[model samples]
Target: MGTDDGMQLAYYIVLLVVIGGAMLFELSGRGGQAIRQMMLWVVIFAGATLAATWWTDSGARQQVLEGGRIEIPVGRDGHFHLEAELNGVPIRFMVDTGASSIALGRDDARAIGIDLADLAYVGTAMTANGEVKTAPVTIDEIAIGDIVDRNVRAWVIGGEMDGSLLGMSYLRTFARVSFEGDLLVLER
Candidate 1:
C-alpha cells in the first residue's frame, strides 16, 4: 500500500484502540454519564483527525513554508513533483536532480504556448531510453510556491516525455536543495 493508504490504516487502528479502551473503561464501573462524555470527546477528536488527514492528503500540505524556504513532499511515486508556472502557464514538473537542465515535454511546451514549428531541434540528450533530440529554450519565468526565477534555461525534448522535468538547472538556482525525510526543501 502507498503512504496514504498506510496513514489511513494507522488512523483507523488508533481509532479502534481508543474506542475499545473507552468501552473497557465503561465496563469497569466508569459512570454512564462519564462514559458518554468520553465518547462524545472521542467522536470530536476522530472527526478532527479525519479532517486534518484529508487536508494533508489534498496537496495543500505539500507546499510548506519554512522561513524563506519551501518544502515539497515526496509523492506516492517516490518523486518530488511540483506545480510551477512556466511562461505564465501552469505546468507540472518532476524533480530530476540528475538532469543537467530543465527538460520540457513536447505537449507541455505546447501547453505553455511554445511554438513547436519555430523550434530547431539541434540539441541531443542521452537518456535511459536513448539519445533524444531537443530544442533549447529560455523560459520567461518559472515559479514554484513563492519562489520565482526569470530567464531560466530549459529545453523542449523532441520526443515524448511523461512530464516536464525540473532539473538541476532550475534546482541549482536555489540557495540550498536538500531532502529531509520525505520532504524536498528548496531554500533561496
Candidate 2:
C-alpha cells in the first residue's frame, strides 16, 4: 500500500482501539468520565500522527534556492541529492565534497548530447568500488533553481554510476558551503 493508505489505516486502527477500550470501561460501570478521557487520548494521538505525516510529505526537506543561496536537506542515505539542468537537460546529482571534480555518469553524459564514443578515457578516478577511467568534458551550463554556472568542468566515468556527482569543482565556486543540522546551505 501507498504511504497515505497505510497512514489512514493506522489512524482507523488507533481510533477503533480507543473506542473499544472506552466501551469496556463504560460497561464495567466506569461511566462517562472514562469514555471522555479515552476520547481525549485518541484526539491527541490523531493530531500527532497527522503532524508526523505532514512533516514527511510536505517537501519541506527538499532543495530550495533563494536569492544567492541554496539549501538542500540531507537525504535518507545521509547525502545531499539535488537536481540540476546539465547543458539544458535535467540530471540528478549527489553532492560529494570528497570528489575533486564533477563526475557524470555515462548515461547522464549521453542524455546531455555528449558523444560518448568520441570521448578519450585518459583520466582515472578511485571510487569505493575501484579505479575507473574518466573522460573530461565541459558543460555549457549547470543550473539548480535560479543558480547557474557556465563552462563547468566535469568528467564522464567509463563505468556505470548510480547518479552524477556534484563535487568541489562546482561547489567551491560558491562563497560559502556549510551544513546546518540536516541541511546543506550554499551561498554565492
Candidate 3:
C-alpha cells in the first residue's frame, strides 16, 4: 500500500479501538468478573500503546519545537507570575491573536464593580455557541505580565465567558511577544 493508504488505515484502526473501548466500558456496567478482567486488559493495552508511541515517534518533539515563541523555565513558585487586569478586575488571559477586541466576562465585569449601564451597546459578538450582545467600555487600566496600560478599550459580553480574554486590543500594542515554555515575554 502507498503511504497515504497506510496512514488512512492507521487512522481507522485508532478510531475503531476508541469506539470499541467505549462500547466495552458501557457493556461492562454489570460489574461481572469477565468485565473486570476485560477492563484490566484495556488498561494494560492503553499503557502499552502510549509507551510504544513515545518510543517510536518524534511528532510531539517537532510540535513543541514549532510552536515555541519563548521558553521560560519553571520558577520556584511552581506557577507563572503574570500581571493582568482590566478595569480593576483580574483577568486570566491566554494570548490569543485571533480575537479582534478585548473580551470581558459579565461576572468578571461585575466583580470589578464595572457599571454595565454606562457602557454602549455597539453590536453583536460571534462566539463558539452563538451570537452575543456586546457593550463597549473604556477601561482605566489593564496590567499583564508586569506590563500595565491605561485607558484600554474592552467589550463586555452579555453572558458568562470562560474568562476575560485579552486579545488583539491588548496584544497589538506590543512590539514583540514570545513564550519560553510557560513564561510569556512581551516587549512594547
lDDT of 1 at 46: 77
Leading candidate by lDDT: 2
- Cα lDDT tens digits, model 1, 1-188, are 64567987897888878876866676676578677777787787779878977876776345747565878888767788888888788897888988999999998999988899999999999887899999999888887767778888889999878788888977887889999988898888
Residue lDDT tens for model 2, 1-188: 64657987887798778777766766666667666776777788779878876876565455655777888888756788878898889997899999999999998999999999999999999999899999999999988778888998899999978779999988899899999998899889
Give the residue spans of candidate 1 off by over 4 A.
1-56, 59-61, 64-66
What is the Å distance of residue 50 in model 1 from its true position?
Answer: 12
- Model 3, span 1-188: residue lDDT tens: 64545985698578658866776777675668657766676777668767865764422211112222222233333432233656666655444566788887776677777887777777788887789889987778875534567888888988667667667767778677666665555556
The lDDT values for all models are: 0.83, 0.85, 0.64
Q: Mark the 10 consecutive residues where model 3 has the least summed lDDT.
A: 59-68
RMSD of each: 8.0, 7.0, 11.5
Query: Residue 70 lDDT in model 3?
Result: 25
